[model samples]
Target: NKGIGGFMMIKNFKASEKIGDIVARFPKAAEVFKIYNIDFCCGGDRPLSQAIEEQKLNQKEILERLEEQYGTLRSMELEDVDFRKLSMTELIDHILNTHHVFVKTELPRISDLITKILRVHSVEHGQTLSQVHKLFGSLRMEMEQHLIKEEEILFPKIKEYEQNPSDQLLAEIISVMEETENEHDGAGDLIKSLRTVTNDFNAPSNSCASFVLTYKRLEEFESDLFQHIHLENNILFPRIKA
Candidate 1:
């Protein structure tokens, strides 16, 4: 009876469920998916069943693991301050403090490290570091402009709309925010290219310290950018529109 009950619990996880929903709802599942090298960020709209099948993993094992990790995921998301519940101002401040600050600190440090890697490891890696440097430099420049646009124009308008609630303002917000989404997509595409050029951020064997650190920082950047986009595109924007 105990085993049967457990099987029933696992059965509740349908293959049709969206991967992002699973991760957002079950924070522990995010780590589990990470172990499987599953992308729960950009490609998160794919079905759970499809994702597991693509990885050729045992569904039962995944379900069992997810069932175990289910506890406290909701609480963790709460502690992270679910964007849906936050006021417009709080959301802006949170984005600036958390995601924006992370990029501002990490990007330049990582850029320098990758430059060092290019100097040291370019021979063995066949210009891989150079490619990464170019892509990352482009991404950083785009993101800086994007962030400034948000801080100077779109975000302030959204905050103002929160207070005033005018149709004219809302229309303008939608127009500018859509442009922001385009920038997000551009940044995302660059990250995807960077990942491809770097072969999914795997440093070569016998890689130096700079090589390893650069790859690590690039992976962290990708992860953070995805979360940043999710907050704006999925949670906050829709809430404002609603």
Candidate 2:
């Protein structure tokens, strides 16, 4: 069995285990899940077997792939600080500093780039670019508010509960987390829509440099957003609830 700081790795990759729990424990498992077209974010609560069966995927192949990848990459990835072992406050701080900052920095830049490409390439790619613009606008709005709620309300309350635990505080935290999670789902749907409209962020062959750059940036944004949501929904919230 793989062990790090006394946290035993899942040796068998049991089908009964929750997908989110597996990703939370083994972050690198996400790469394999993505290749299998698994939804590890919004649809993460389901069991491995259920997801595989629903998607008509072969369970044994996925399990074997996860175990093989985990074994090969465990030393390189798990040698770093384990996120599960971090204190609640520390985890919150990391999210705020890392993910929050990235969102704030990229949203406006991507918005401008998208607008430029839309204006320049509207004649040919008008419909798709328009859809991308509209979806990104909704995503930007949702994420802006979501960040405010986390930084202003939910995060502070969590810290307070850590400093002085109480049933009332816990209830408040749970309420806010649920609301935040719903917002997460909304943002996630918008992202999926964006991906669909942009053809998974694949730029056309004759597209300008700016057009290609916009698609690249959007893909980067999606990747970062997935990691951000995975941390909160899979790791942080479960820790709080436990």
Candidate 3:
């Protein structure tokens, strides 16, 4: 994060630009918006100007913070390539290779951690940990099947559409993307439920290392899942046959 005076000059933001578009472009803004309880996910269609006014927020401060946070990225020599600019084929490949692989790898590891923590700490944190484990199990199962569906059905059709674009194929892409987005929402809802139950990733004072580690890993998993969904929902899906 940079100082307000060190913030970048953002001339591209339009008055009518929605909050989701802002987060999709400047992800750091998501944190600032979250501070104000602004929804940049499901109910993110409202314009920034309107949201600020309605919530009695300081528009200038929000803009300054967003620019400051985004400025840090500008200040750094980052190797991160923007997935949105890639060709449809390239983007789909990157999603499968990057985000999908990460979810698969991290999900199982965290699942194991949660299970162990629940068993060991069952006497102390059993109720909450148990709920977290069950919710996470459901989420993991959903994601496992979700990735398979994308790999076997969605990505192949997207690739086929890339080779031969047509109105019918475009409709199919839209339909599949819609279904995929819904599943993403379901997974997101489950994570939110877990977060609520866990007091936003705070570990109990008497928590063991495993307990702390499980909460930390769960938070990391939630962050990755959000970024994954944002990439597909905000960027890739919109480019289909555009």
Model 3 per-residue lDDT tens digits across residues 71-144: 45433313466666689887775565446645765777789999898888899788998899899999999999
Per-residue lDDT of 112-171 in model 2, one digit per residue for the tens? 999998898889999999999999999999999999899889999999998999999999
RMSD of 3: 16.3
lDDT of 1 by residue, 112-153 (tens): 988888887768875777788899999989998998788789
Candidate 1 runs further than 4 Å off: 1-80
Root-mean-square deviation per candidate: 15.7, 16.6, 16.3
* TM-score top scorer: 2
Give lDDT for model 3.
0.76
Give the per-residue Cα lDDT of candidate 3 at 60.
77
After superposing all C-alphas onto the true structure, candidate 1 shows an RMSD in angstroms of 15.7
Which parts of model 2 are misplaced by more than 4 Å? 1-79
Q: Estimate each model's TM-score.
A: 0.66, 0.67, 0.66
